[model samples]
Target: MNVKSGSAFFLKVIAILIGIAVLAVCIYWLPAAARRDAIERPGDYSLYPLLVCAYGVCITFSVVLYQVFKLLTNIEKNNAFSELSLHSLKLIKKCAFAVIFFILLAIVYLKVLTQFTGDDPAGPISLGLMGILATSVVAAFMDVLQKPLKNVLDEQLKND
Candidate 1:
């Protein structure tokens, strides 16, 4: 394989590894982490659901990464401007939006928890906000990237 193909292969490997790691974290580490948190703050199981939500978000992220890997594969096969690639980008954008939406929901949940329970939710709230910002940026970038590629695909289709 040429350098470009090698790079794409490497990226695909990395994406697969990331997805595996995320799955491990969600399956093994998350419940443990939540249990630890609960043990540390006895009687406060409120964070449990949030932890589950975080796992859900991680799963979404993993799906998006898989989509990215598929996109890269399409590129390697010289199908970068095809409808499949366009659909992959569209799916990625939607996943990013889902991430943003879920993070925002978590932030609101945290805020409400603080209001009712008087627990200091500052740390988790801030983290959720950061997640929102990061996912928002990803969504925006995907949106920007998709538009031109979509137009190019449209032109290609018309020409064909």
Candidate 2:
């Protein structure tokens, strides 16, 4: 295979691995954390629902990665300038926005909980803010990328 195809394949593999890792975290690590909380703390299940929400966000993130894989497949098939690629990018951007929204909601919830219970929410709130920043950057980057890609697609259509 040529370098381009090789790189596309590599990216596909990486996306799949990331999906698997996120799945494991959602399925195993999240539950374990909840179980540890229940066992060790006994009465504090306040963060349990937030953990579930985080898992939901992670599942959405995996869907975004799958969209990326589809986009890469289109590129490998020389269909990068097609509507399918545009759709994939749009879905990825939407997913990134969804993640940011969820993180923002989590931050708000944590802030309220801290206000009520006087528990220090610094670490989790900071992490949620970081998540918001990262996903916002991704959404902005995707918007920038979409403009040039849309131009390319339009140009290709005119040429055809």
Candidate 3:
């Protein structure tokens, strides 16, 4: 009924979806036509590496969502939004740094794409994008959580 409850439910649903996707890729899709094609093709044979990276990314994304949902529920219970907000801010900062670092690395990889001369460079690019996107989502969630804490802090200061 409340915002926190709704957010928690949404996060659980997302986790489920991510789990399903990972399973589909690992159990169903990868062992079928895609794997066959990758083997038959005369490329870099990076299918296994790509699949592993993708699985890791999906897992990490789901875990982050779960953590944020848990944080929200805890915030609601303890009325300690200020402390959690600060923690979220720290997480946001770290995520931002990670995004920036990945972006730079991806750019360098792209610049040197020609040197690879093995197969398509899309795998690394896609992985980098996924990382950037995941960090962006977490950072945005932190920003959303920060608003209420900011309001509470401001109201407390005004009362004082």
Candidate 4:
């Protein structure tokens, strides 16, 4: 296979693997962590808030991954420089923002709850911060890419 198509193939594989990994985390890790939280707090909190946060995260990240897949498809079709790919990048950035929003909301929720429970919020807060940072970086990357793509499209329009 050619270098371009080969790269797209590899990226597709990577994206699928990432989806699987996230599914596993949602199925396994989240439940275990929730159980631990319940055991530690006994009756201080319900899992519903955490579940909502997880649901938001999963939804947004899934959109990001779907956008990545669409972007790769555009690359394979030689349309990576076109409006469709730009739209995909825009959507991915939006998804990143959604993820950040959810993380911040969850952090705030945890902070308020911990204040009442007298529990240390450090652990979850730190984790949420890291998630926020990561999501912000993804949004920034999409912003940078979209700008170049817009510039290219503008230049092409002028030439045409």
Best-fitting candidate, scored by lDDT: 4
lDDT per residue (tens digit) for residues 1-160 in model 2: 9999999999999999999999899889988989888998899878876886797699889989999999999999999878999999899999998888788778888988889899999999888888888899999988998999999988888898
Runs with alpha carbons beyond 4 Å of true place in candidate 2: 158-160
Model 1 residue pairs with clashes? none
CA lDDT, every prediction?
A: 0.87, 0.89, 0.62, 0.90
Candidate achieving the largest TM-score: 2
Q: lDDT tens string, model 1, 73-127?
A: 9999999888888899889889988888778778888888889988898898888
**TM-score result, candidate 2:** 0.92
Better of 1 and 2 by lDDT: 2
TM-score of 4: 0.88
lDDT of 2: 0.89
Ranking by TM-score: 2, 1, 4, 3
Single out the weakest 10-residue window by summed lDDT for candidate 4: 43-52
Q: TM-score each candidate.
A: 0.90, 0.92, 0.51, 0.88
Q: Taking the tens digit of each residue's C-alpha lDDT, what string does model 4 give over 1-160?
A: 8999999999999999999988888889888888898889898566669788897899688888888999999999999899999999999999998999899999998988888879999998999999899888889999999999999999999999
Judged by whole-model lDDT over C-alpha atoms, candidate 4 comes out at 0.90
lDDT of 3 by residue, 1-160 (tens): 7887676667767756776776676678756856686779857554554454445544444455455555656655755656665665556555455554646555455646546765566776676777677667767766876777778878888898
